[model samples]
Target chain A: MTTTTTTATAPPTRPVVSRPQERPFGLIRHSLALGRRSLIKTLRTPEQLLDVTLQPIIFTLVYVYLLGGAVSGSTQDYVQFLLPAILVQTVLFGGMATGVNLNTDIGKGVFDRFRSLPIGRSAPLIGSVLGDLIRYVVATVSLLTTGFVLGFRVQTGFLSALLACVLTIVFAFCLSWIFVLVGMLVREPGGVQGIAFLVLFPLTFGTSMITPKETLPGWLQTWVEVNPVSHAMEASRALMVGGSAGTHIAWSLGFSVLVLAVFAPLAVRAYRRRT
Target chain B: MTFAFEAEGLVKRFGKTTALDGIDLAGRQGSVLGVLGPNGAGKTTAVRILATLLRPDAGRATVGGLDVVRQAGKVRRLIGLTGQYASVDEDLTGTENLVLIGQLLDLRRTDARARAKELLNDFGLAEAADRPAKTYSGGMRRRLDLAASLVGRPDVIYLDEPTTGLDPVKRDDVWTIIRSLVGDGVTVLLTTQYLEEADALADDISVIDHGKVIANGSPAELKRVVGGQTVLARPADPARLDDAAAVLAAVAGRPADSPTRGVVAVPVSGDAAFTEIVRRLADAGIAVTELSLRLPSLDEVFFTLTGRHTTEEAA
Candidate 1:
């Protein structure tokens, strides 16, 4: 047994090591590490893949077979028009998951853990968005492959088709910041889900995703014309099927940049304010 | 001597309600400062501010001579915080959670992995290291969370009611772990509703109520605030309690209180008081079943100081 010593002496305070000072670009390194964490989480729970994987395939196949003859005279013709719209819908839904996941993390005290760490303040927010890029890639490939199997050919060159896929993924990544902002302010995953969809559902459906804007009523067409989703879909459609895509691509990119500028800082600020 | 951490006139408000009203805290390096408070006493708020999780509305706080708000990143490097809830990622395995924290603290991948393994083994969680934290028992998850905080070997650790929901066995284990950390010379700021916990572990205790420090001292000092030592006895015969009480009163020089059947206790002042009571009881032919001279319980001290009952026992 140890002897009891009550000397009234204060405990010794050892010098703390100040090594491993935060290096330059430490934010990027920390974000990448957290991104890897999100990726591993996705891998473990493969069900998180269902929204990006199964939704695209189902939407492409069902739309082409069920509404093809009625809307565009042939399933082949309809697949050409519907594939990009389906991909856009898939990515939009994919973006909502970012908010839901972030809300869940905040509610679970995971964000508190991150905040107490020495990492950059913005790392967790940026990392989750970066990791979600994989979901977009998964959706894009599944939609394209299913359309190709259904006899939908990309008239544009492979380079243009690749650009179309990249455009949708980038747009979705930008939109995720908006959801991240919502996630930070909201307290529950279910609440985030409801609010995000309430904001997104009208935008996706009111646009020309399921039908041509010209075929819609005047009031609806007016909204569809200004809808960013329509611009993104038009950009993807023009790139995949041969057309002059410069204006649509510029509009899509410009809109995404504007959203990113407005939402990124707001999301990060909200995150910092939370405990 | 420089404090490991200190907060002066800290104030935080949520809407119209002030969560912290000029709360002040100071802790010496390598010493334990136990923050004892009932629910909604702003203990967590104070810890959060010191941990750099939230900015105070007014007043200044520092960790290791760095400002909490202006130098939050540096302060973060100096402190490890285990919040009131287990903050480990439920979706990640125990090993993964620790490694993630290690890497976030700027450790290389291999180093993070090695540290993660070492922490898991040290916390007796090697068997469940690969299992998702969601599957862990409450105690296991708390261990993993604490392990994550220690991965960076922070100079100061903030344990915010870490043992709140734990069973006694698990709580003892946590206490042992905390003692070892203190032995390694890490400064600790622990917040608990359990006064006994503070008495058992703290070098000094601060009792907070309504966002203000109501009492601050060592356990013995706080006990003295309530009263002096008490002599208690239970006679072998219920009828002999009166004789025992009279003997105790004569020796203690104060009237004894019979709190329950066959039990009499009275406040006593000196060491000779115990011997005097035993001699007097024997002379009076009072056979005692139980006898002891003990200080007042922390519960009594808390009630005497705050004039309110504790919501939970100091287990």
Candidate 2:
């Protein structure tokens, strides 16, 4: 019995091995890794990066050259007037890419994979939203560079111009959460795009992103004055043009806080449901 | 020994459709429990609950003594789950996928990289570690998925149809990996529609149909439940098939099936009946070409219990 046992043990012990010990990371670490992966994907796909860059440049040129005379009466005046509007409109439109990417990820079953892992529940949602900041900054810089080339001046000085640009991007970053919520709620990519367009088109185009609300019809003017996008655009315009801190600035800041409060939780809730 | 995983009266309903109806299961540590079922039989639902991915409408489940509902985080720490399809990010490389999972499970950056390298080498993916998962073959992707699940070194793993789409050779490769995992004392709950897969891997088999576990036991025990033994006989000569059939009929009380082509099958109850049939055939001077006594297979058992063959069911 002893001899037989020794022979059996020798063969079995040669093949049998121990399992490795596991060490789990915290939520913050996981969220950073997810964010890094998203950024890497953005770097690898330069062709897809053109949307945010081109839209800001083309729209700034078109409004500055073609519609500048009709709207603001002078090219320089239109450049000053339309630059801030272009900043707000371009950044807001840039936020839509987040929804589209999220929709694509969900359609491809990427989110389902995240569900099975032991990672933080909020990591994917938060990381994806944060990753789009790269695009927002890219669009903002391209629009600013184009406006500068066209002889547009920032009378509020370099520091204030930088702050205004930051505010516009930050506001756009906040607005992306609303689209992230929509993306999480809708599973299909096309459906997400349609929902995003329906929500964004009127909000940006109908508001004061381009012209002052005082120049519109009485009923149309009333709606535009209260619109959150209008408030954001007007506040941003004031900051760039060396205007006073008035109701538009107060309303824009208030609207930013309100949008974040309402949509952040909704987006997180939708993300939980998705998993 | 205490069970590695247990579920008691697990009931889950999606809208008005009852997916699982009071199912209970207890699996021993370091053993493979194969769940055999047709489609819509709640096999996936049971795995989901055990993996802490779904909540039961009513019931309790525990992994390593941690409640799946009340202590989901702890249960998740102890368990790893691989679903029907490969669930890794296709945009990431194989190494990136495994390392990401390791990092999520809390490994240090260096440690995660080391673990990822080891897993890639172990799964024979070292050469393709840097290639994006979208470029991998089906077998490679499946292996990477399995490697991803093992990144946490889970005490118990839930594999729901791990070999659903693999060819015969690749399926056998996965079976080898599962055996190694069990050797390391990891308890596994495997669900699959292929009866042969269950026969190959399961130490204990549970047959589920229509949201209920109709049968559960060791493979040999369940096969015994079907009936006694069957004696199959085939004639050497095609023309003399009926003669052999008549001889078998006279010996066994139960009528033999008609000689199809040149073979006749007769079901026998016991060794005595089999011996009598052999004696009668010898005495008739008819040389039997083939004679064998065998118990029913799991396929037949499924048919006998469910009143339908596995192939006929749209699983």
Candidate 3:
């Protein structure tokens, strides 16, 4: 068979097309661009906002009014105690959205488009985690605003409160890598949701996220005290309210780093193979 | 001659099923090499491998002379791919999808925007440029997907059954766009289970079956391999069918196969055979409602090579 390149060699029929030079930091740049796309998706589909915007409000109300007295003896006293836990729970839930959205994106072949592009291999996952951080920020703010309205105050001052929010969001971003791995491994979006809920339910509720670890039964207390959610709750509590912050902060940061070190590479590997 | 796309002895397996078994293909620069296959025949598998979307188990392939495995990043820069499913973001507007791809391709922000608008207009999607792709009809979604792939204007394109779910008119639109891309000297590797699509688009064709290439040639060359064409005549009077069949058989020096009522089809070697059959029918005093010479279609070529017909679903 005659190759068309023969003609080009002879007479050069077509103009020479110059290719775009690869950017030095194309991975980070592409990730930011994709992250912006994901954020716009959240904006256009406002129902995705419900978890951050509405979940905290309703959950805060339920904990303060219905279960507040039973847990902390009074609604006024419980708001300060319950607010940080609620924020942790909210960010945790927000973090799981990463896995679900990633799974759905894979199912719908969006990543196929990304995979074919000359972009970074891990850009989609990194971009997704970054975009979902917006959800975490919204949840943190909503929880704090609702808590303050319900008589909660940060005893440790404004900087501490800001630190607490940043710490929690960072921890949530790290925790999303675990769910990102789950999302990449799961067969379907629904399956990701199911597995995420299964893994998260016991970790969040059994910890000091709502009721104190001291009140739990002896055997369950062991698991609750060691749970990463409890450590995050304690870190945020230490920063937002007055407490010994160093140990809890260390543990939360340590857990975040460990989870990232483990799951981030695994998720990236799975993504490369699966896509 | 430098091949824009080339694959040799490519083998891929998913569990126990070999999706591709030692398949080989080559497409010259600025030409379309159609990989036509039935479902489970590894058309998509081959395209995916060449597109740098999958790894071949045992073969080496190259695009623009860059190794697909080792020089994948360079290969990606030189090729654009459109899969069977529309890969544009459903949540984003058509403009957003194209712009995002442009940005990912490392275009300047303003340049990307300009290119997106130009593509939207070229694809006849300018009116719906700001609307989310979810709202697009199947054809529009496909057009947007194709438009997204062109944002980089790569040297080679891999289209994996791009018109699978599109209506006839939409498929034709995609065909036109593909032709224009080739007209601009873009080499294309098109995979399709549809015989007619390959016939319409490909300069050269490879027929794959059960993960192997059963045949490879230009469309006319492949049709010749199946056999010669046939001359058919339908008698005006049903009672004269035998007479027309006898005349066709006498001139063509073969048995006339009557597949339908009042119609006789005789295999003819060339135009001379056609002329002799017409003269003989006229001498036999047979009045026919229709008379024509029909070349064997890709369908017949496939049937001759493989015992089974192509279907939408894979085995």
Candidate 4:
């Protein structure tokens, strides 16, 4: 067969171009991006959502059914007492997510990347702490909805209930700063968990989550009264149960701010060292 | 040419261990400086300091005339860094990873997305742009990591073993990207354990050992330090190998070593020695099959300066 060969010529394609734009550097923008990325991860990881939602519901149900009659006089009374405690317990435990997620990111070399970036120094710490607020809100709403479904009523008005919810979330949000510091100080995820538990267990269990501090032994009563978490739980419970707000609320708000003020800087300092 | 980066007596210590021992390095604008060393040789430490991720305990470093320690924010604005491994958020898609960096760099949302798209296309990651980085292959993840660093169009890029785990082909792809980066007037400080990588990509190389720079020069200049032309001779017949060896030995006046099954190697002083050896071998009717003179490879230079073979010392 006779054939003729011809070279194929094609028209030139447009050159690939990138139009660069100037970027501004500020704390707010950096923190917002850091927070946005973290929230996006939470959206992708449903398991993270499940932990905050499922754990509180199950823990509240089990505690009310098993320990209600023994701990309090009646199931309804126990429900009233248990709901606020569950709020504090669930949200405080949920704060562990901050440390766990921070440890995971650091272990995976994510923080190393953050270190190389030209972003605000406190962005990651603030972002992760703020990100855990989403988890806290989820747990709070789940517990409150479950309590309402279980025939537990909030004697406080709607505004008070909303305010109580805000206080609980804010308390948990501040608590996360401590765990964020723990996460930065410890290199391993398990170490973060251990340290978080060591600090949280005493602050939580030594308080009056189920029984009133008045019912405890003299020394134990004093310990519970002095426990910052107990004051937070008591203030939240009193506010939700139609009791008059007192020094407990002031102390809780003051203590939450104090913890945040102390730990936020510590966490930021540790994060700087870590990166 | 202006120095894109100049570090004078950069010293860094972690606890009592000195990670960098007064390292002095400079890279010209639009050129590549490859820091070659084994593991624990302080290559990464130097890159970290230059990238503004770590502060030097002594001396000073500057990128684009911004001090790495005192003016770290300005230095950071002028540089991008891709570390030994991919450090993007795996939970996010490749596009999201780049976009997040763009946003962190303070790009508006629209600008960030546009920059992300541009980088994804430039890095050959457009097809997997929507896929989470965890799903990407090692090479793709590395490319995405590089793309994320370029979101700000940094003037100086620090690549710390950018091809550490990549296969040869993938490594070549990265090398191509690095070449294009330098072609775009971007300075690169590359750290690598692969000597051939330095020989291929570096405008100048510094070989560090035990936290100190033991040698620094262009690849050709460094290779010349371990002087002598390598003479390779192959005999026409396997049985005549000894004759060829004797010829090489007699002409060179040094012991000839057999590198292969039938090839003898001798160090020649110059081209005259090479011609003389070839003449001697031809006169003996040895029918020399192969004769060539080669300058020492970077491996030989590394061995001569460090007193250890690259491969052996690397292990």
State the C-alpha lDDT per candidate.
0.84, 0.78, 0.85, 0.82
* lDDT comparison, 1 vs 4, better candidate: 1
Candidate 3 chain B has its poorest 10 consecutive residues by lDDT at B304-313
- Candidate RMSDs in Å, in order, are 5.8, 6.5, 4.3, 8.0
lDDT of 1 by residue, B1-315 (tens): 868899999999988888899999998888899998877889999999999988999999998888999999788877888999888888899988988888788877777888888789889999999999999999999889888888877778999998988999999999999998888778899998876688789998888877888888887787566555778899999988788888888887767776557789876767788898888888888888899987644444455676545554331
Flag regions of model 4 displaced more than 4 Å: A1-25, B227-299, B310-315
Count clashes in each candidate, considering only residues at least 3 apart in sequence or on different chains: 0, 5, 0, 0
Clash pairs of candidate 2? Answer: A23-B106, A24-B105, A24-B106, A25-B105, A25-B106
- Residue pairs that clash (backbone atoms under 3 angstroms), model 1: none
Q: What TM-score, to 2 decimal places, does chain A of model 1 have?
A: 0.90
For candidate 2, report its TM-score: 0.83
What digit string (tens of lDDT, one per residue) describes model 2 on residues A1-275?
01111111122443222233334446677788887778767876776679888998898888778877888897788898888767888988989989889878865534555666666677887778777788888888888889888878887877777777787787888888889999889978788889999998888888866666677899888888778778778777877887864777677767778788899888888877664
Model 1, position A90: C-alpha lDDT score = 87
lDDT of 1 by residue, A95-152 (tens): 8999998887666667778988988888998999888777888888777788889998
* Residue A251 error, candidate 3, Å: 1.6
Query: DockQ scores for all the models shown?
Result: 0.37, 0.27, 0.45, 0.30
What range of 10 consecutive residues in model 3 chain A has the weakest lDDT sum?
A: A1-10
- The better candidate by DockQ, 2 or 4, is 4
* Per-residue lDDT of model 3, residues A62-127, tens digit only: 878997899889998888898987788888888988999988887676677788899889998899
Model 1 ranges with Cα > 4 A deviation: A1-19, B228-298, B311-315
